[model samples]
Target: MSEKRIIVTGASSGIGEAVARQAVARGWQVLAVARRAERLEALAAEIGCETFAADLTQEDAVAALAEAAATFRPTGLVQVAGGAKGAAPLGETTIEDWRWMFESNVIATKRVIDALLPLLRRSTAAPQQDGSASYAEIMVVTSIAATVSYQGGSGYNAAKSAEKQLIDVLRLELFGEPIRVMEVAPGMVWTEEFSLVRFGGDQAKADAVYKDVQDPLSADDVARVMTDILALPGHVSVDETIIKPVAQTHPWMVHKGPLVAKG
Candidate 1:
């Protein structure tokens, strides 16, 4: 079978990094995109995959990323470059925080998709080794907050909800095209940076968020689901997958145990 290439955004760390590594391990070429040049270089050194350092939220950087990706002609794209900002109540949330959330999550996803459409279309025309239909896949990693609202989560929830809606509309618009749009909403993922960044680098607060959880999902756990969905036949499209650790029922519901900090 011919090699399959994929572009993974937010590949500097967490779920995006895991997806890039896992894809490379599965014999697929990966173009890792992130804002941290040092981190991307480290990942490329470790995994031997191409790396592009660019902030997707910037128009010029995203355009450059798309141009590089077009040359690679990746058959798949995984948009994982998004996060939550200040966890303030509706009235307390600053306009800047809300705008940042929307820009990072919704606007960035749309920009990357728009810039890569030509490459994605070209991928669709390539012949499949198995003689099956050729399909280019686009996966977005949204959060469970997209559907469920919680206290002090209005800004994040709104942003993620918009991203989800965008994916839904894209799927419907590209129904007959050889492109598959999928969304993965993960809950309670225990990544080192996610909570830390959300809490403004307050280690204590970040640690408290998952202190009592029996077993929280790791970045790789979420990436595994993405890889599995991508591995499916081109004719099969897993439209939306909501994945959570067994201890998590929803965004607000979680099974808490004794608080224990790992050294």
Candidate 2:
């Protein structure tokens, strides 16, 4: 079998980084994409995968990325480059922050998909032993914020909700085609920078988000779920998966231990 090729966006950190590393370990030819050249370079050095540094929000950069990706002809595209900017209530959320969230989560995802559709289509052209078409997968890493609304999470909720809807529509549009669209919605993942970024680098504030939370999900945990979905038989598609730690049931409902403040 030819080695499988995959492109993972947001490859500089968090779930994106984890997915890229895991993909490479499983013998896939990985193309890691992110805006940070230094981080991508470091990841490439460690994992021996190809890297592309481009801001997905920029049309010119996305175009260049598409040109590069055409040569790879990847069978899978994992979109994981997204996050929340501020935890402000609807009225207090800055328009700038809301726009950033939408651009980062929804618009960026759409752009990358549009740019890579041609390469993704190539996966279907590969010959199969059964004379049936092979499948190409597009897996999006969304958040539980899409499904449940919480106080002070309006911007994030709206952005993720849009992304989730987009994925659903894409799946319906591509139903008969060999392309498979799937989404994984994770809750309370405690990565090194997720909370910090959301809280504008306030270390104490970031740390407080996960304080006393038992075994919160990690980037690797989410990556494992993504790769497992990809490993399924070509004909089998897990349309949507929601994963969270046992302590978390929804966006705001978390069972912190007694020592943790409940407020």
Write down the lDDT of every candidate, Cα atoms only. Answer: 0.91, 0.90
lDDT tens per residue, model 1, 1-263: 44678999999999999999999999899999999999999999999999999999999999899889978888889999999988877998899888989999999999999998789888878678877668888999999999999998999999999999999999999978999899999999999899898888999989998987988999999999999899887668999999998878878888798435669
**What TM-score does prediction 2 earn?**
0.95
Per model, state how many residue pairs clash.
0, 0
* TM-scores for all predictions: 0.96, 0.95
lDDT of 2 at 133: 64
lDDT of 2 by residue, 111-161 (tens): 999989878887788676666668888999899999999998999999999
True-vs-predicted CA distance for residue 48, candidate 1, Å: 0.7
RMSD (Cα, Å) for all candidates, in order, is 3.4, 2.8
Model 1, CA-based lDDT: 0.91
Off by over 4 Å in 2: 129-132, 258-263
